[model samples]
Target chain A: MAALRRRVLEVLPDLDPAQVTDGSSLKELGANSVDRADVVTMTMDDLGISVPVREFHDVRDIGSLARLLRGHLG
Target chain B: MTTRSGVAPDGVVVTGLGVVCPTGADVDGFAAALRAGVSGIGLRPATVDGEAPGMRPRLVADLRGFDLPGRLAGLPQLPETTRRAAARVAGRSPLAIQAGVAAAVESWLAAGLHRAELPGERVGIVVAGHNLTGALAERARAGYQASPAHLPGRFALWYLDTDHVGSISQILGITGEGYTVGGASASGNVAIINAARLVAGGELDACLVVGALTALSAMEAQAFHNLGAMAGAAGADGPQQRCRPFDTRREGFVPGEAAGCLVLESAGSAARRGAEPLARVAGYAARLAGTSLPEPDLRGEVGVMTEALRRAELIPAEVDYVNAHGTGSPLGDDVEAAALRAVFGPDRPGPWINSTKALIGHCLCAAGVVEAIAAVVQMRGGFVHANPNLDESIAPDLRLVGRRAEPAEVRVAVSNGFGFGGFNTSVVLTSTTGRGRPSAARR
Candidate 1:
């Protein structure tokens, strides 16, 4: 979760830390499509995990995205 | 407005200049370095990524420490929104793209376009570079090999050379027309000519001619070195001494990296905006040698010089100075000197000549626009910069500036660019003091 949030903030430095709740979406935090993909790829690299492409389509929010990557770890 | 031939009768003027190179980061710093004969060439550090550990140190002039955010902050004149956009947009991009952003911002402000303002639909950008993905692709190779899916998604957009056009256009809000143009080493001049034509043809009121930094990978560097076209293999004394254009001791060119920008506009538009003109793009010509080889062609070189003068409607004797494409290679310098003598002649009292490459090294694809900025600097600053390393003249009768810079009121100057694979180009730039439309006056 922290890694996802960190990557999101990396792309949008102007976003307030309090607004980065897992329930919130990257789009809500002002991350464009390119920024969303960058954050996802960067987070994947940071966690040393590669989630399959189709699985990411199920991710509704930051929390769901983190949960999917964590499933790869477990 | 465009004429029946689709060319404007009005002149095109350079309204702004920017540079990010090893010699300096801005136009003012670059101008001072040229006047003092400062050489930015040095040994590429072995620790740099992708360099072999046991290989000999290669000579290169790198922009040692460029921080894009810091560079933007230094430009107090830039709007806060634009500065933030530059950082947010290109901070995580490759070094070359970041350098282009800095140069673009500097030139945008210098042109006073930000304060005066123009419709976003009327401004365009032309990026001068190709194969700009060498370093980034090489760096990503190992990562992809480890895990192919882990490659950053932004890589798709960033890898293309037109990333310069997209990023700069998005940041500057330019929407008229934009694309990347290539001519190998002559990319800069090609971009300039394209941008100038776009403005002259009335397709746009103004356009930015950006010379994107060429970040060569080790493989590309090794190829040039293996071909015996790069210095530092045998031309030793020091890194600075290796780039000796027009000198007998010159072995080959020393590679340099830089990005530059020029804002070219129609004369009437500039006057309407009360923008100060830097230099006039009086005339230019580009020709092919009909060969796909790497060697310079004497006929192509001489042809462009002659045609450029014909287009400018100025005689050879009227050309006050020449910013030569002397890359310090033995055969290349010999060919260029012969071309100069053929056009301007040995006994005819010709234009003073010097090579910006002697001080800043050869900037590969960016060399043309970088040297174009150098030519404008010398022209407006009232002096021709020194050749720095011309110990023995390749062309003694030519009035090449010696060890130190000299003062002269330069009105008309020729800036040349030649690339491998038969691209040859010459641009005629005239200072504000020069007459307006010599041929038009005759008509």
Candidate 2:
């Protein structure tokens, strides 16, 4: 989880981690479709974790997405 | 309305050109494609099934392989290259700058006009774009999603709303006036015309016009796919099937991304620098058709073209070539053809016509200038290139050149760019020598 947090921070240092906690909504913080796509593609390239395009269709929070990536990696 | 006459009022020349098109990054490659009647459309491998289907809207002049140097690459995330490009042209970085501001400064430098030659107060800037706010929104989202604690780092909103204008002013050090305009694709043309007006009125001796738009994100691409507006990949058919402009089987337009800038100065100033004048901007006019987004009013399109001619004091016969706003969509093609017929009459003889979008794909906000560059090339070359992928004629009286270039004694050319909201713009370009007129009279 800490590794995920650091990776996310490297990608978007301007984001507030507290607001992106496990249950926080990315949409509430202005995470749009373009952003989500960029995050997915950049993360896949950097983290070597392939995120299914469809998963991003409904995933709303950083915590949830981290968990999804962790499940896939495990 | 005080209507002025002659090439002087219409005589704003194109001294220099810079391009970032798919065919070739510079003017030479793009000119070659136009001469050879090449089609840039091909299958896009990245698109998925749920997206729009057909031939993937690829540029007959693909820019995918062209790489900007590492120095220029930083501009998408930072403001450095935009500044450097401007400084390379302007001799100095503008104090505070915007994306479009650097472009304007570069254009002025390309024109060989020095900053000290003209009064800074007499210089102005007009820029156009469709997605300024959208860019900010995307950046803000990226920052927020990465971490909630670094809210201040995602300054997309602040940068877009405030810094855009501030940066431009700071770079140019223009204390006079500046503004942004457009209705989507027509924005660039509209901005050019606005700057021309200020210069003609003597309110400013020089005006810089800039147009730019970024690439569509996956979501925006999907939105266009949902609208059934994108051209899909060519299947078993060859590459020519991808985007058949003015063809009987034409399907739709492909979206592209680009930015361009032009500096307009009075003839006196250009002459002072011994800069050879290119084609002149004779007349410009814009009109709106449908009140809504999807619907296009054909009548409005015809009216605007006719009005542009009227403003230039030119008859239909005077126009030698037309750089069409043909997007390859069925309705768009038919309606634009009908509008041309209405203005030119069904019997009008061979006036060379073509669409640059067929070669480069549609560059959204940058479409106007991209096509404008093509028209200037045609005017200088005295020939109109044929349209590739045009297997059969869609309009009877109109000449749709295919597979071969045709010679033309082009005196006047018109470029049209119609945006989503039925925003239509027609710009007239005339030869520097005033083609048909006597030399002494032209002087």
| Maximum-lDDT candidate | 1
Compute DockQ for each candidate against the true complex: 0.84, 0.03
**Can you write out model 1's per-residue Cα lDDT over B55-151, one digit (the tens) per residue?**
4438888998888988888887889889878877887999999999888888889999897467777788999999999989999999999999899
Model 2 chain B: which ten-residue window has the lowest total lDDT?
Answer: B88-97
Per-candidate local distance difference test? 0.87, 0.64
Those runs of model 1 whose alpha carbons end farther than 4 Å from true positions after fitting are B1-7, B47-57, B233-236, B434-443
Docking class of 1: high
- After TM-score superposition, what is the CA distance of residue B143 in candidate 1 from its true location, in Å? 0.9
lDDT of 1 at B252: 88
